[model samples]
Target: MSNLAARLRARRAHTRTRRAVSKAIDTATTTTMRDELITLAQTHGYQKSKPRV
Candidate 1:
């Protein structure tokens, strides 16, 4: 019984931690940041460049 209770408590804590991490990741990757990343990638040659006029 005690071991089962301990496992439940651990699972709750793990769930809370996973939720926080996922929320953080969602907030960190905004559209502007994504665009900046794309530009950065192009500069670094990781993304293909569009043909300039």
Candidate 2:
């Protein structure tokens, strides 16, 4: 039915948008979190900081 098809399309669109948004947020947050963890370790002498030339 046309109505069913329309509903399916809308649902798919919503799912795709949600997935894309979550993926974007995940990348940004994970990047900062990883950086923070590495810095924290270095500060506590658990990890050494690489010298920047």
Candidate 3:
């Protein structure tokens, strides 16, 4: 019983860590893409337009 409980705890911790790492990677990728897009728009003399309601 104790061994099973330990295994379960370890698995949960591993899952949590994996999820955090995945989220961090996703956030970094999004930020990098956004920066690249802004740079590209600036190079092409494009300004951000306001959204219409």
Candidate 4:
């Protein structure tokens, strides 16, 4: 019984870790995609260049 409980706890922890990793990857992907779109727009002159302050 104790062994089963330990296994369950370990499984839950592993699941949580996997979820955290997946979320991080998703966020990074979104950020990179946004950056790429912005770059594309700038390169194509769809977005105007900002003046230096």
Please tell me which predicted candidate would have the highest lDDT against the true structure: 3
Q: Which ten residues in a row have the lowest lDDT in candidate 2?
A: 42-51
Q: On TM-score, who's better, 2 or 3?
A: 3
Q: Which 10-residue span in candidate 4 carries the lowest summed lDDT?
A: 42-51
Local error of candidate 1 at residue 32 (angstroms): 12
Score residue 17 of candidate 3 by CA lDDT.
Answer: 60
| Candidate 4 regions with alpha-carbon error over 4 angstroms | 29-53
Model 2 alpha-carbon miss at residue 39, Å? 27
For 1-53, candidate 2 gives per-residue lDDT tens digits of: 99999999998876676555444444655778757755655564445323469
Model 3 lDDT, full chain set? 0.61
Better of 2 and 3 by lDDT: 3
Task: Kindly list the per-residue Cα lDDT of model 4 for residues 28-48, writing each as its tens digit.
Answer: 557787566556555644453
Give the alpha-carbon lDDT of every model: 0.61, 0.60, 0.61, 0.60
Q: Model 3: clashing residue pairs?
A: none
User: Candidate 2, which segments miss by more than 4 Å at Cα?
Assistant: 29-53
